[model samples]
Target: MAIEHADVLRAAHLARLGIDDADATRYVGDLSRILEMVDALQGVDTEGVAPLAHPLDATQPLRADEAIEPDRREAFQACAPSVSQGYYLVPRVVE
Candidate 1:
């Protein structure tokens, strides 16, 4: 999986990126190394290995679901220009 200079230039053009010749040369080597690393990773054996959500065995503590504040819906709705059936009314913008 070797990345060429022409490939880098084409990718840059497609992405609308402004890259010089020196930067393109550097990217060709960097991209080639990244692909080589990916190729190496693909060669690993993991036939019966199970996937894990997290590396460490830990559980997050959660608080009990309970309301701690008093309801003030009527008080807040009093400040609105229009409200109907426990909902704020808004001017229609579309037909």
Candidate 2:
């Protein structure tokens, strides 16, 4: 799966990249190597291997979902400039 010069140019064009002659050659070599590696991987035998959600088999420690602060909505809303029907009112700025 060797990437050619035309393929590199086309990829660059599709990606909206401004690659010059030297960069295009470098990209072609790098992309070709990457494709070769992927091709090699496709030939590998992974029949018995189980899929893993995470690389490490460890459970994450989490804190209990309990309320740590008391409800103080009324105390906080008392400092607002205007509030009615448990809702804050603001001046109408737009139609």
Candidate 3:
């Protein structure tokens, strides 16, 4: 899990990051320590631990789905920069 300068440089190239020689050495050591910590965590027993999506047990009430008539279209269209036939007109992109 000890990351070398070569490994750091290779990782930088893969991630499209431009890392200089001085920073490469420092970054390699940091990355090595992180990898070591992860490797150490492999020794821990996490059996019988239930995976949770949310930290707290909470649920939102589902509302009934039904289509309903909305307010005035003319009023809504009035806010648009440009509107025609209840639709906003956007600038043309392709010729």
Give the winner by TM-score.
3
- The Cα error of candidate 1 at residue 75, in Å, is 29
Tell me how far the alpha carbon of residue 17 in candidate 2 is from the true structure, in angstroms, after superposition.
0.7
> Which should have the higher lDDT, number 2 or number 3?
2
Candidate 1 vs candidate 2, lDDT winner: 1
> How should the candidates be ordered by TM-score, best one leading?
3, 2, 1
* Candidate 1 lDDT, 1-95, residue by residue in tens: 99999999999999999999999999999999999989996787878988778888987789899888798999999999999999899998697
Report the Cα lDDT for residue 39, model 3: 96
Q: What lDDT tens digits, residue by residue, belong to model 2 across residues 9-60? A: 9999999999998999898889999999889877878899887779888989
- Kindly list the per-residue Cα lDDT of model 3 for residues 1-95, writing each as its tens digit: 67888999999999999989999989988998899989997797879977777887997779789768687889888898999877789998697
lDDT of 1: 0.93
Candidate maximizing lDDT: 1
lDDT measured at residue 3 in model 1 versus the true structure, 0 to 100: 94
- Per-residue error for 83 in candidate 1, Å, reads 35
Q: Candidates' TM-scores?
A: 0.44, 0.45, 0.46
* TM-score head-to-head 1 vs 3, winner: 3
Model 3: clashing residue pairs?
none
